[model samples]
Target: LPDIEGELCRIERVRDVLVRRESELRYMMDDIQLCKEITRLKKELQKLVSIPDKDKLKEDREQEEELLLQINKLVETRDFLVDDAEFERLREREEDREMAASLQSKIPKALAVQGESDHESVI
Candidate 1:
């Protein structure tokens, strides 16, 4: 007759080993899921931190543009003032030259008139 009791014991031992291996595999799979969750959370954190940096960069760009606009306005104003001063200087120089010419012509006519009066008194 076969030893049925021993055979049954041997089969139970094999079943127990399979069940333990399955438990270990389940634990390992749970760990893998936990690792994936941690990685996703880390990525989310990085994005949150970078959002402020992006906003700051946008603000800096706007400020730089404003400064450039101010600089351009100052340059234009300087150019206008310089042009006005140059035009005024030229006009004043032209007026002085005209006044000198008029004075010189009047002086010669007055000298001629004086000489004629003297010659008639001597005769």
Candidate 2:
């Protein structure tokens, strides 16, 4: 009987330690997520500020708004985790395509537009 009680006590202690570790891991995950969100927001703000063309900046207003919305949502949701892996993947793909298009348009496309309107349309 004493041996059984000792085993049960040991199991309880192990369970308690596991529970504590799990809680710590949850906090750490939250911290990591928060940091990632902050970094993303900073990068987005930097990009928005660095755009040389007013038209390009205006075109990216919606993206900036979305980024701000995401940041705000992250700030508000203290307990809930929002996974944005899929969204990030899609956004990155779109940005890559836009950059490719923009670069391709810069040479012959700019000369064509030089005769008409001075404002260049951004992808």
Instruction: Give the alpha-carbon lDDT of every model.
Output: 0.62, 0.69
Clashes by residue pair, model 2: none
Give candidate 2 misplaced runs (Cα > 4 Å).
52-56, 79-123
Provide the lowest-lDDT 10-residue window in model 1.
Answer: 41-50
Deviating ranges (above 4 Å) for candidate 1: 1-56, 120-123
RMSD of 1: 51.0
Best by lDDT: 2
lDDT score, candidate 2, position 23: 59
lDDT of 2 at 7: 94
lDDT for each residue of candidate 1 in 7-30, tens digit (9 for 90 to 100): 885697678667656755665565
